[model samples]
Structures are given as C-alpha cells and as structure tokens.
Target: MNRTYLTNIDTSISDVDFTQHKNAVFILHDQLNLDTWPSWIREEKPLLIFIESAAKGKTLPYHKKKLVYLLSSMRHFAIECAEAGFPVYYHSTKQHYDRALKDILSQYEDLHFTFMTPSEWDSRERLRTVISEFSTKVEEIPNNFFLADAEEYKERVKDGWLMEYFYREMRRKTGYLMDGEQPEGGEWNYDEQNREKLPKDHSVPSIAETETDEITREVIEMVEKWYSGHFGESEDFTYAVTRRQALYRLNEFIDERLDEFGPYEDAMAQGKYDLFHSQLSVYLNNGLILPKEACDKAEEAYKNGNARLNSVEGFIRQIIGWREYIRVYYEAMMPEVREANHFDFTNKIPEMYWSGETKMNCMSECLKPVIEQGYSHHIPRLMVLSNFSNLTETDPRELNRWFHLAYVDAYEWVVLPNVLGMSTFADGGVLASKPYVSSGNYINKMSDYCKHCDYKISKKTGEDACPFNYLYWNFIDKQRETFSKNGRANFMVNMFDKKSNEDKKAIFESSADFLEEISRYKKEQ
Candidate 1:
C-alpha cells in the first residue's frame, strides 16, 4: 500500500521525504552535497537526479575547459551517488528549467521528489514555479553544505548586514575564533599584518602535488574533446577531481603554508600561484570540500603549532567572512540585483580579457593565469583585473559574465556578488562602500606589475603612460557628481580636487583614446 506523511519540518532540516511513490528523484546542483539525499533515499528508495550544464538565463563565453570541468564534475558526482546504492536519473539540459521540469514530469508520473535548495537565486525561483505547477506535493530540503542557513542568517542580521558584525557573530556562535567568549586573538582582524609584498629574492615553495587519478584523467579528456573551442588552455587543468584529493590539498596548505598566509596573502609574484595562498577554493566551491572542514583544519593547525593565529583568523574569515557573506548577500538581492548598474556603464569589454593578450602587464599576467590554469589569487582578481574593468567603465554584466566563464570555481551565486557588487560597485553601494578603482600606483604598491610594463607607471597622459593612470582619473571625473555625495567617496573626491582642470581634461582625452583603442579590439573579437 502506498503511504505519505508530512512531519514537523524546519528550514534547517537537510532532508525531507514524500512517501507515496516507491521511486523518488533528488535534484542535485553541481555545488550541493550528496549527504542531503539520504533522507529522501531512506523514505522513498527513489532514483536520484542530476542535470548537466545547468546554467540558465544566458549563454556565457566560457573557456572550453571550464565548461567541461563543470559538466564532468556533475557527471562524477552522479556516478558516486549511484555507487552509494541510489538508482540515478541524470540528463543534460539545454532547455530552460521550466521546460526541463515539464519534460521530467511528463516522463515520470508516479514519482515523489525532493530537492536541496539551489544556490543561485534564479534556479530557486524557477524550481518554486515548477513545483507549484505539479499536483503532487514536492519536498524542499535545506542545503547543509553551508555553515549556516541563508534564511536564518538573513533574519539574524536583517537590521545591519555588515560583514564584520556577521563574522563576529559566526565566530561567537561557533567558537571558531573564540577563547571562552573572548576572541582568541585580541583583535578580530589581521588586515594590518597581511600586506607584505613579496621580496624580490623570495622563493615560493613548489606546489604540494599534482596527481590526477583515472576519474580525473577521464574527465580532463572529455573536457578537451567537448570544449576545445573555449578560450582557456586545456593542458593546464590540474585541479583535484575528488574529495580525497581536495582534502590533501587543504591539509598541505595548513601544514606547509598557513603560517605565512596572513603576511603575504595579498602579495602577487611572477610564476607563483601559492605563495602563502590556499588553492582550495576550486574544491570548496565545487562541493568536493566543506567550508567548516577547511575552517576546522586551519584552527587545528593553530593549536598544533603548525600555523599562527593571524593566519588561522585570516583563512577562517574568507570562509566565514567573504564566502558566507557573499552567499547571503546574493540571496538577499538577485534577479533585480543582476540588473543594477550604479555606474550606468556602456563600454564594451576589451578583447584581451578573452585572449590574454594585453599590453598592460598586470592585466596580461592576471588573465594569463586564468586562461592557462582557470584560476588567479584573490588580490589579482580584486586589485588587478576587476579594478581595471571598473576604471575602464566596462559594463558590469559583461564583466560579470567574463569572470563567471573564466574561473573553474565560478558560479552565479558566488561570482555575481563578487563581480557586480564588490568589484564593480554595480549594486550601487550594497556590496561595497566604494568602487575598488585604482591607478598604476596602487598596482605598483601591491605587486611588481609596474616593473615589467611597457608604460611609465607615474605618467598620466602621453602614449608611454600607464593605461590605468588615465583610466582611473577619467572614471573619477566622469562619475564625480554621483560620487561626491557618497560619504565613502569623500577621499576620492578630495583627491580629485587636487588636480587642475587642464590636468583632468588631459586625462579625460587620454582615457578616451585608450578606451577607443580597446573598443576597436572588442568589436574585432
């Protein structure tokens, strides 16, 4: 006899079941955890579900390897779910979610279903509409992959969503950065300690390991075959394909590099991807590893004397501070959020973003890493590439698409908050108090990009001048009236006042020429 029951369920419960059908489907996103499937499996013994290339809304200009990486990762997760004794039903969807759901419902009439909430705002909205259309009830499961629930966290921090306050609350609640209710370190942040530039003679340690097993090898081969037309180099894809490999990478960072992570976290060096930087974001974002496990490992390293408090705090802040904050912020504002254009930017993105063939050394170096390896450190992302995009008046949506396509770890939920909000200030002031616009001087201060560039770093107007110098002031000058009223923009306005009208006009003309040249290349691409 078929039976169904609905019990008391809160949003925190990671699992739910509809007991009538013997067969059920668990729709899994690429970033969702497999453990959330057990409750549905135990009750209905239903088949599992997965969708390949689940990206909807727009077709992105992604590197071929990135496309393959996401699809292959989804396939691998499906295989593992099958091995765990769940009958799996997986399909690649080129249709929109509504069409895909209609197709699936048409095929399986007697199936009960449960789905972990999708990370992306659009996906969740689509699922809501689709499920409402079905006569049969569907259970929505909580996503336990995150350290805290999004809805709950939103309610908790509704009054003020500042990251510092939220981060402090998380540390207090979890005892992550605490010692008997006091912070382990006297200070909550170690920002002052984490700004050392790499010494010219400094040597970066060789990466811990690069060993891919049979599954990863097969995934890589499939990516190369299917996505050869995309922009990135296929030969440089060497990320951990499984949870085991991801753990190894994390442990290696905690053991060998975490102690120095804080002091050099923002430093960029030539031919170095891991100078006191954790390369585990690819794994964490892909669901191969959890943020809590990473945080715990870093904390353990501090206790074991393998790392320092500053490093542990800094690492934890990325997961708890930036990562969690971004996820919450994305959920709070989306759909409409994506359409925001505080700068009203209309300029096209440069072709060099796709080709990695820019004359600007910082842009070239940063884009080369992304094109070749599908990754770049955070500083290069915020300060170098995104900074330039903001200064050049590149459309935030276009820039957002480029970022989402370029990185292996890129997903709409994570990348949008970072790109549109923090990087570009496209959300006005919701994500960032001010745009992270900077000149070649800031780049020179942060990295050795100036030493290698063809232009004079200090010059603002001539042919041999740095592009960033002119672009930076031009951005400020163009947007001066908008920014003049913003409290956070007061410093930049004051800096603007220091320049004479002729000097500003000269910068504006130089910037116009530079942007025109970039626009020509964009059309060619």
Candidate 2:
C-alpha cells in the first residue's frame, strides 16, 4: 500500500491513498510560454491551472485595451495547451486568486501544487502567504521569462550600478555586439546617430492589422462589459494575441521599419502615432516573445545588410541593455522605493492628461494617441507627458499610478522606476543623472507642434508665452540646490542666475498663474 501524507499536519486525515496523481502546475498570466517549463513538468503533463480573477482586474482602473489583450492572449494560450494534450483546469471566477486556489486545494486529497515564482513583488508576497498555509503541498520554481538571471545581474553589477556599465557587461556576456572583448564598431552606443528629426512630409509605412479570432472577439466583448468605465477604447485593438502573430510583427518590423528606426527615433509628428517603433513591448513584457529571439532576428537583419548598424545596435540596446537594466533596478529598489519623494510634490496630475483638452499642442498631440488607443512611443512619453508633469509639480505617486493605469504595456515593475525615478525625479536622481526637464525650444526644434500651438514658443514670460518656458525656469529657481550638485544640469542654474530680476519675477508670476489655473480645473463629476 502506498502511504499518503497529509498536505497540512492534521491527525484526523490518515486514510488517503497516494497512488492517485494529484500533482498540478499553476500558470500565471505573464508566464505564457510553454517552452520555459521544466522538462519533467512537460513530460509528466500534469494538470495545468489558470485563473482569471475578477478581483485582479478591479485593482486599478486599467486601460480597456490592456485588459482585452491579457485576457484574449491567456485564453488562447490555454486553448493551445489543451490541444497539446494537457489536462487543463481553468477558473474564470469573481473570487481572488487565494480564495480560488484554496478551494482547489481543499477539494483534492494531498494535492501537490507547483508554480513558477511570480514576477511581481506584491504577487510574490501573496504567494508566500499561501505557501505558508499549505506547507508541504506547494512548491515554486525559478522564473525563466527574462533573458538575464538574477544571479547574472548580481554577479555582473558590483560598482556604482550605472546602466552603461551593466549594459556593456551584458554585451560582453551575451556576445551580441562584441568584437572580441570590445563593442562592435569600436563603440558601445550608437545613440548619437539616432537623434535625427523626421523630415517634413515623410511617408511612414502603414501599420499591419491582425485579424481577430473568435476567442479574441469574445474577450473584447467581455472587457467592454466588465470595464465600461476604463480609460481607452477596445474597438481599435490590433495587438497580437499569440506567439505566431508576435513573431510576424517582429519580422514585419525588421523588414520595413528597422532601417529608419535609428535616425528618427527621437522625432515626434502630428498624426503619426508609432512612427518607426517596433510596438512589441506589449508582447515582450507579457512573455509572448523572448528578448533573445527578438535581438537575434535584429542582429541577423544587420548582418544581411537589410538594416544599418546604428538601427540594429540601438534596437538591441533596448532589449539586452535598457530593458534588462530597468528590471534589475526595479528588483534592487522596491517596497521602499515606491514611497520615495525627493522633491515632496503633493499636487494632483493635470486634468488634461485624461481629457486631452490642453492648449499646448505637444501635450495634446502626444496625449491623443494615448487616450484613443492606449499607445505612444517613448519620446512622447518622456518629453511631453512626463515633462509636463514634472513642470506642474504633480505628485510622483499620482503620476506613477496614472502611467500604470493608462498604458497598455505598463506593469508595476517598469512603471514605478520609470516614473518616480527617471521621469519625475522623485528618488533624488537614483536612476537619472538629472531631471529630464526642458523648455519649449527643445520641443520646437524636435517637432512641428510649436507651429500649431496657440501660445508663442519664443516668449519666455508673458500672457502668450509657452507654459513650459516659464515653468521650467521657475522649477530651476526653486530647485537650484538639486541641480547645483549635478554636473550635467548645473549650467541651467547658472543661466537662471544670469537672468535679470525683472525677468525672474515675470517667470515666477507666469508659472504661479498657470499652476493655479490647472489646480482649479476640477474634473467634471
């Protein structure tokens, strides 16, 4: 007779049979790749569990497209796993994950549960509680979704933890663009060549649309019904929901957009939403495509002379360099990092972020794509959206929450560091060397937004002056000490000091009036 041990220590449960197979694997939404599973789990073909918890969706006012993408992709992956001869048990319920999991564990005798470690810190803590309660029944394996391992990051990053140093180390380790020991082309970065503005009237390649399947259509309807009050529209959802479609998108980007992606990487335009961006962050963050595969394809394109070295190197840096570095930063600085407020801003985010009703053309144009489709490239996100928030003195936590709720590709791990540390300077320059604050002249040089705006971009202070012009100077004047220590930003303080007292007074008055006006803009209830 096979002896059966109780999952929890209880003297009353002694008559259970151990011959029956009660092993199962729980798959999270982000861990959608079946190939990443351990070999024994794949061979045993144990029962697979997937949970679509309504409580998780209600945690935030998430973008409609984000919900639709996650749900449709998860349902499709479940269907694929079932077709691959796995015994699948999927729960679509209103209960939280813990409650639903407890029910499953109680229904079976000595049921053993195995799952990979969750990517999120909050989710991991919750799982820890369940593991403690279950004791002998639950086991967690290491997560394999990302390219770099935690041990690799720890081993490689020893000094000041600068991104360039870590990124160069990663290049050497992966040998992606290394020439023996040095970087290919004798340079570690091609970012200088990637800053050209888009020529006027330049035609961009049209975005390819994906044909929606029945499962996706069902998910769209469900998202519409459940998240009626969410921010974005689900009707224009064209994101790839499967690995095959994601791979197709990667190939399409390489063949069409990769050549021009580097030169105009920083350019912004009136109606062009994507420009030359790969638009694959939604898929990559959710594990539909691996980073190594994406980098490999781009490297192949460069080798074949289909794309330039600048474009290919820039693209590879995003994956193996910046993306990997951000994850490491997020892991090393969390739980306490969330509450970091170096500047101590307490104002709410501007109402125009949600309404798109600003007179500033750059803010309005950049926010249009975000409001309509839940998408925009990084330049618009950094220069326009985050820049305005920093100038207006919006609370970093509030801005971080907005980004998390607004973007289709955002998660806590990415958004927290990007917003509080880099975007808003909330962490006192932990991630950024200096605050990414700029005046209107930079925007005027980079895009055609100034040509269509109501305010004068040339004016530094007056009724017709661009708000960024006055607001930027005011920010510098107030935070002079912060910039005094920063070598890259100290010149701005000297420039502010050279301004006449009359000009300084005018800047303060203009910034104060604008801040007051925005503060009074209460959202329509």
Candidate 2, superposed: residue stretches over 4 Å from native? 1-21, 151-160, 519-525
What is the C-alpha lDDT profile of model 2 across 250-277, one tens digit per residue?
Answer: 9999999999999989999888889999
Show the colliding residue pairs in model 1: 24-46, 64-230
Give all candidates' CA lDDT scores. 0.74, 0.83
lDDT of model 1 at residue 173?
A: 78
Give the root-mean-square deviation of each candidate in angstroms: 6.6, 6.3
Report how far off residue 518 is in candidate 2 (Å): 0.8
- By TM-score, the best candidate is 2
What's the distance in Å from true for residue 496, model 2?
A: 0.2
Against the correct fold, how does model 2 do in TM-score?
0.94
